[model samples]
Target chain A: MAHITVTVDGTSYKGEVEPRKLLVHWLREDIGRVGTVVGCDTSNCGACTVLLNGRSVKSCSVLAVQADGSEVTTIQGLSDGNEWHPVQTAFKECHGLQCGYCTPGMVMATVDLLSENPTPSEQEIREGLEGNLCRCTGYHNIVKSVSYAADLMSAGPTKGAK
Target chain B: MIPVEFDYVKVTTIDQAIAALKAGGEDSKIISGGQSLVPVLRLRMAEPSVLVDCGAIDEMLGVREDGGSITIGAATTHHAVMSNPLVQKHALLLAQATATVADPAIRHRGTTGGALAHADPAGDVPAAALALDASFTIAGPGGRRTVAAKDFFLDYFTTAVGPDEILVSFSIPKCDWGSHYAKFNRTAQAWAIVGVAAVVNVEGGVIKEARIGLTNMAPTAVRASTVEAALVGASSAADITAAAMHAADGTRATSDLHAKADYREHLARVITARAVRAASGI
Candidate 1:
């Protein structure tokens, strides 16, 4: 076992992890950050997407040891107290999800996408979220949510949350 | 799916990585980015006794200019490769192809050397490396050696890199030619069904020279020498179309769930023509 120090959300967690342990398993099973759900164990689905060192990466594809000195931001850490993040607010306002199984990943991916491209066209938004898959809502509302989220983020500080 | 338990050693230098690999024996595997290796590990396809994590090797991490070529560290992620100004200016084909690899998340974590060393025939980068005439530098206990991209891939999921050697970097020559990578995939994140990488030098509206690489056309990435030969001095769209007919001349394409052998051959012809046309600005 290798000892590692990983800062998740905002808290630093120090522990011993097996070399074979995936970052997603360690986050959910070990630390109870179940907000980052695992859809397809394979890397195809982006349900396990999280920000690693300020860039998005699939947690399932990353070994826990690889993230020893890194900071990871999952969906659980997006909001501040009772106020939701701009992305979470946009998803709720635009009805971006139906079953909501893929919402956490979708919302996290949107945060990363908007960070990279603040103003994306419809085609660019679709292309940016290509890794994420949603079996419900046909992705029309999800794309709308991303566009709305972009508007909310660029409008200075976020307003009162619902 | 949990991978089998294994010992992990993280090394920050190439020499230290080599020592770890040598000590771990032949069953030891190197992990960089872990985009491809982790998936295989979870599937239980590869059960290495030791996983030497070389992702933190500082010396093997960025892009630099070496004389007339750009030497990219093997551990450079695909996102970095696509966005690096040096690579974008010198090896645009590589940037274009790297941009099409999986999605944004995968690109952020997948390394150029990891993809090249993995050597999946359906992968997008190997063909781009071949078209750009990239050379791989590998480091072993006996020191370092460079292998041409053409001779690097030996078979399916195999390369000239020995088990005990670590791929250090790739040197791609700078070219003042038009290039394009035309990939056909069922989905945005899916592997290429049949892809073509074309680099063409047009002089006075006539093709002066051309290099073409085929993906998923054989056990390994192969050059379309016949099509390249046929494209010289071609000045029209019809000329490129006619030349692309020989795309599958000596390829050993296989039938898979994505496409039949014959269909892949047909795609090779059609996509090669499109790639050449776009590359030469015809």
Candidate 2:
């Protein structure tokens, strides 16, 4: 086993892990960040998406050793300890999820999309989140949530809606 | 879902990676972005005993412009290539096709070299690279060498890159060609059933030159040289449409659940016409 040091959600972790340990497993098993779910072990489903150095990546497709010395932010770390991030609030208010299985990955992917294109058209939002799939909701409400999140984020540093 | 047990070593230099490959022998597979290899490992399609991680190799990263050509490092992420000014200005086809790859998250992790080395006929980048006449530079124990992109892809899930060799970079000449990529997929993220990459150089209302590359219509990404030959000196959209009918002239397309060979041929012609029209700015 090789030792790897990584900073997840703002906490630095050092552990001896096997080479084959996937990042999604490492996040849930080793670091106790169960918020990042693995809907499909194949890269097709994006339920395990997270931010690696501020860019979204499917954690299920990434090995823990590959993330060595990198900073990873999962759905659990999106907000300051107390309140939900704007994207999170937007999802809740807009009813963006039904089963919530794909929520964490979808929300994280949106954080990436909005940061890249602060004001995207509905088509652009749909295209941006194409990698993340949802069986419930048919993506209509999820698109609305992203639109709402964009508006909330555009309103400046106010805390997300309650 | 979990990959079988394997030994892993992360390397910081080209030589170190080469040495690791040599020591680990044939069972060792090089992992750059892990966007492709990891999935295969998870599915148990490959059982490599060791994985040499080359993600930290700084030498094999970024884009460099030299005189009339740009050399993209093998490890350069798709996101980096998509956003690079040099690629946008000179190789816009690459940038345009890259934007359509997997998605933002996969783009963040997949590398140009990895995609080319994977050599999947359904991938968009290989056809784009072929239309641009890109050259791949490789390094192995015997030293370094270069191979034309046309000769790089040997078969399905195979490449000219030997197990002991690493694809170092890809270089393409600067040209005044306007290009377009036309891809057809059932879903937003599905692989192309049949795709076409077209590059056109027009002067004085006549086609000065044209290069057409067809993807997933053959065992390897093959050039629509017949269509290209028929398009030279042609000006009208009708002329382009006529020439594009030959898009599948020499191809050996297959019949699959996604699309039948005949349907793929029909789509090839239609998409080639569309790509050529957009590329010629007509």
Candidate 3:
């Protein structure tokens, strides 16, 4: 077993993980961050996407030990508890999900995308979220949510805590 | 899916990594980004007894210029390669191809060396590397050696990198040629069914030299030498199209679910023509 110290959702957690333990599994099982769900462990469906040191990556494709000295932000940690993240609020407002299985990953990917390209064209938004898949084929709404989220974020900081 | 348990070791330097690889022997796997290795492990495709995490190895990272060549650390992430000024200015083909690799998340985690060492023919970087004539620098207990990109990839998912050797970096000669990577994939984040990377060195509105790299059109990334031979000193679009017609000559393309051999061969010619035309600015 390998010992790892990682900060998730602003809280540091220390644990002994097997070498083969994936970051998605470690986050869900050890760190109790179930918000980052593992949909397709093959890295195709980016359902386990999370912020690793402010950059988004599929947790299923990363070993827990690789993230030992890194800071992780999951879906549950996207907001300050009082208000929803801009992407989350946009998803709700734009009806960006159906069945909601891939919503967390979609929202997280949008946050990373908008952070990089504050204002993206329709094609850019679609291309940006290509990694994250929605089986419901609700991409039309998901793209809308990203556009709405870009607007929300560009409007300035959220009403709640940073 | 869960991977088989394995002993893990983290190395901070190339020497330490080589030492671990030597100690672990053939049963060990060196993981840089874990983007490719982890997926295979989860699928039980490979069950290595040990995993040497070289992610923190400071010696094997970054992109820098050495005279007229750009030496990219094997551990440099695809995102870094895409954003590096030297790469964008000197070798834009790499940047163009790297942009088409998977999506944003994978780009942030996947490394250039891992992609080359993994040696997936469908990977965008290998074809780009071949077209750009990049040399892979490998280090082992026996010390360091450089292998040309053309000779680095041996077969499907295999490379010239030995079990005890780590691909340290890739050195590519700088080129001021117009380059483009045209990929045809079924869906977003899908591997290229058939792709072409073209680099054209044009002078006085005439093609002086042409290098074409084919992906997923053979057992390994193969160069369209026949087409290249036909393209030198060619200027007109008709000349390029006629030359690109020979793109699949002397190739051992195979058929898969994504496409048939004939279809891939056809795509080789068509995409090669398109890539050459765009690259030569005609």
User: For candidate 2, lDDT tens digit of each residue in B1-282?
Assistant: 789999999999999999999999889999999899999999998899899988778878999997889999989999999999999999999988888888889999999878988889999999999999999999999999999988998898788899999998999898668899999999978899998999999998899899988999998898999999999988999999999999999899999999899999999999999999999986
Tens digits of per-residue lDDT, candidate 3, A1-162, equal 889999998999999999888999999998789989989878989999999999999999999989998999999998866778888888988899998999889988999999899999999999999999999955999999889988888887753233
**DockQ score of the complex predicted as candidate 3:** 0.91
Please, what are the lDDT tens digits per residue for candidate 3 over residues B29-146?
9998988888999999999988998887777889999999999999999999999999999999999999999999999999988998998989988999999999989998889999
Worst 10 residues of 3 chain A by lDDT: A153-162
For model 3, what is the C-alpha lDDT against the true structure?
A: 0.91
DockQ of 1: 0.93
Chain B TM per candidate, please? Answer: 0.99, 0.98, 0.98
* Superior by DockQ: candidate 2 or candidate 3: 3
CA displacement after TM-score superposition, residue B220 of candidate 1 (Å): 0.5
TM-score of 2: 0.99
**Position A33, candidate 2: lDDT:** 97
Candidate 1 vs candidate 2: the lDDT winner is 1
Report the Cα lDDT for residue B182, model 3: 96
In model 2, the Cα lDDT at residue B45 comes to 89
Q: Per-residue CA lDDT of candidate 1, range B38-61, in tens? A: 999999999999999888888789
A103 Cα displacement, candidate 3 (Å): 0.6
